[model samples]
Target: MSHIFPRHSAQSYPVAVGGEGCYLIDDTGKRYLDGSGGAAVSCLGHGDPDVTEAIKAQLDQLAFAHTGFFTSAPAEALADLLVEHAPDGLDRVYLVSGGSEAAEAAIKLARQYWVEKGAPSRSRLIARRQSYHGNTIGALSAGGNEWRRAQFGPLLLNVSHIAPCYEYRLREAGESAEAYGLRAANALEEEILRLGPDTVMAFMAEPVVGATAGAVTAAPGYFKRIREICDTYGVLLILDEVMCGMGRTGSLFACEQDGVAPDIVCIAKGLGAGYQPIGAMLCTAQIYDVIAAGSGFFQHGHTYLGHPAAAAGGLAVVSAILQRGLLPRVQEKGDALHARLMEQFKQHPNIGDIRGRGLFRGIEIVEDRESKAPFDPSRRIAANIKKAAFEAGLICYPMSGTIDGKHGDHVLLAPPFIISDDQLDELTDKLSQALNAVI
Candidate 1:
């Protein structure tokens, strides 16, 4: 009997004793391929020497320095590197501990920005349905995932939700992808008008939907239209790149590929490459200036904000990614991985769709291909697939509630950037076995 509390106490779990390259080893000495990088955190894979060394070096020198008192070299350097690589106008970085923290900071910053600019009425937030910002209260209120928000509805602040740009399920038969994209993106405009444009502070979304929707990508021109809407309404665009940014999408920032620069962006998970927990919210110079000139302070701080060791790990991870030219490699491997998945599942009746970009891919499951019907939620297809994959020496990220709050299932694949072709082949093989055994 273990004294430690677990995520799910009803079920036992393997103790992950060690990790190397793209695989994790259990206490029993079994190696499981990290197919989803533990929810897309380990971009450089496990046991990265450079990142580990950076963390250790930072710890040796100094571990904690409160932001109110001082700023460390690692924090400054990390911020500089991130800004240099960030989208145009995004000149400031507010470092935080993880995805939820990043989201919380972004929300507060947006509200503060509006207030500083004399738009105190801009307090409402609009996000897409089926999207996930984070788990904290403020972030949770901004998120639109039904299951996650259902129980917390009473406690959550009022936030509006519009339809997401999910083309596969929502796209009409006669509609071109571009047309559907425009239609979906137009939902924001309608929502803004309904809520009174002056009252809305920001519109939040994940450039590439992760976890909740399983690596879903927006259609062409979708984000361009979204950017246009934000600008037209004076609404700040906040892109939550917690799972898809930092080279996971084969681009430094996923929004770059979409050719749109958000006013505020939240990033995490892959930022530190699982070497250390770190996340940051980047905002435009205009927003920063408004708050700086108005309040002379942002009115937010965390005990671990600008943590030296985490910043060091993030800096090292970004440095290694750029030095090794891993972004292009992610694109190349992603192409190979997509091809392998298509080849393997193209003929499978239960596999409904295979889509995504770079190392992040999703395999949507269905009971009938023609109808695109989901399996019974009670059947727990995604859960069974995850268990089967793990038992077969592969760790995957599978989740239910894909269609809404309770209906669909998808397996999200986000292998480490360091994964090889052979490892991809292994991933597909194990996935096929898991699907066959469970689905």
Candidate 2:
């Protein structure tokens, strides 16, 4: 038996030996197209020379520097780059090792900001049902995915979950999409009133729900209403862009498309583009000023918070994204991918819905398209599709419990920004074969 523990203990996985562009090669020389970018992390594909050289250079200068003692050049530069393109009012950055840490920091920063402002009662956090932030205890508490939080319930903090702005499922019959968005966004106001707005510290959500719900986009005007409500109630709006941010959605930040900015935002995945493990939590100048003026410290950190090498990787990855002009390409290519998917799956009985933005897209699997009814959980549709896809030389992200914690199934496709027209067809073909194999 292998000494290393895997994600799934019961199953043995292929040993991936190398990655070239958008494909991963196994030890046996089998190549698998990176359709989902390994949970949407590798936005630059793989084996990027620029990113590698940057990492190597940084390793020579400084690999790691304890943030408690000294800060590194790469870390500082990375922060500057992030703020340059950050949403309005967000001017500070807190570096972390990965998405979970960034999320944990965002939550703690929200609480501490309130404490600094002398509102000790602002302890409750409000999020959306069917949303996912991270897997760490504090972050998990804020996420509304019942399945991810079930076993850890006893340890999670109290969090109020409001309905998500999911139009396909929650929009009532005969309701306009815009009207449904407003109604869904209003749920936050109701929750705040019930919890006494003063007691709620922050409202956390993803601009585009990932992983658990696939690439579920919000209805029009949803986030604008959400931002207005947060401002009125003095609640900090925290946007978790761990998967949807950093040019994945054709914009540097996914909230840019929503036309609303958050008080705090967490981002990862595409930051280092899988060249290095990294994430960051960004906040407004006002929040930083309050903490700086009062305690002079935010009071939360990890040992690897700002490792130089990781920051170098992130810096290069972002620079490549901006300098090479990948954002607009993402838009053009994404539209092409969506068009191809619609053309291919328009009549697929099991392909219930094809929706998403830019390179990040999702296809909901269902049993009844007219009713939008999902496949039964017992069918293990998502799992079966994932296995079939992998076996057919593709790597796609598919998950169950898309509707709630157990009702729906979806396949999330987030290819690298460098994916080509031919590659898009290859992705759809492989996905279709997988779906056919399973359904």
lDDT of each: 0.95, 0.94
For each candidate, what TM-score against the reference?
A: 0.99, 0.99
Off by over 4 Å in 2: none
Candidate 1 per-residue lDDT, tens place, 1-439, comes to: 8998998888899899999999999999999999999999999998988889989999999999999999999999999999999999999999999999999999999999989899999999999889999999999998888999999899998999998899889999999999999999999999999999999999999999999999899998999999999999999999999999999999999999999999999999999888888999999999999988998899988899999999999999999989999999999999999999999998899999999999999999999999999999999999999999999999999999999968999999999999999999999999999999996
Check candidate 2 and list the clashing pairs: none
Deviation in Å, model 1, residue 100 alpha carbon: 0.6
lDDT of 2 at 70: 95
Residue-level lDDT of model 2, residues 1-439, one tens digit each, is 7998789998899999999999999999999999999999999999999999999998988888799999889999999999999889999999998999999999999999999999999999999999999999998998989999998999999999999888888899999999999999999999999999889999999999999888889999999999999999999999999999999999999999999989999999999999999999999999999999999998998989989999999999999999999999999999999999999998988788888999999999999998889988999999999999999999999999999998999999999999999999999999999999888
Clashes of 1: 0
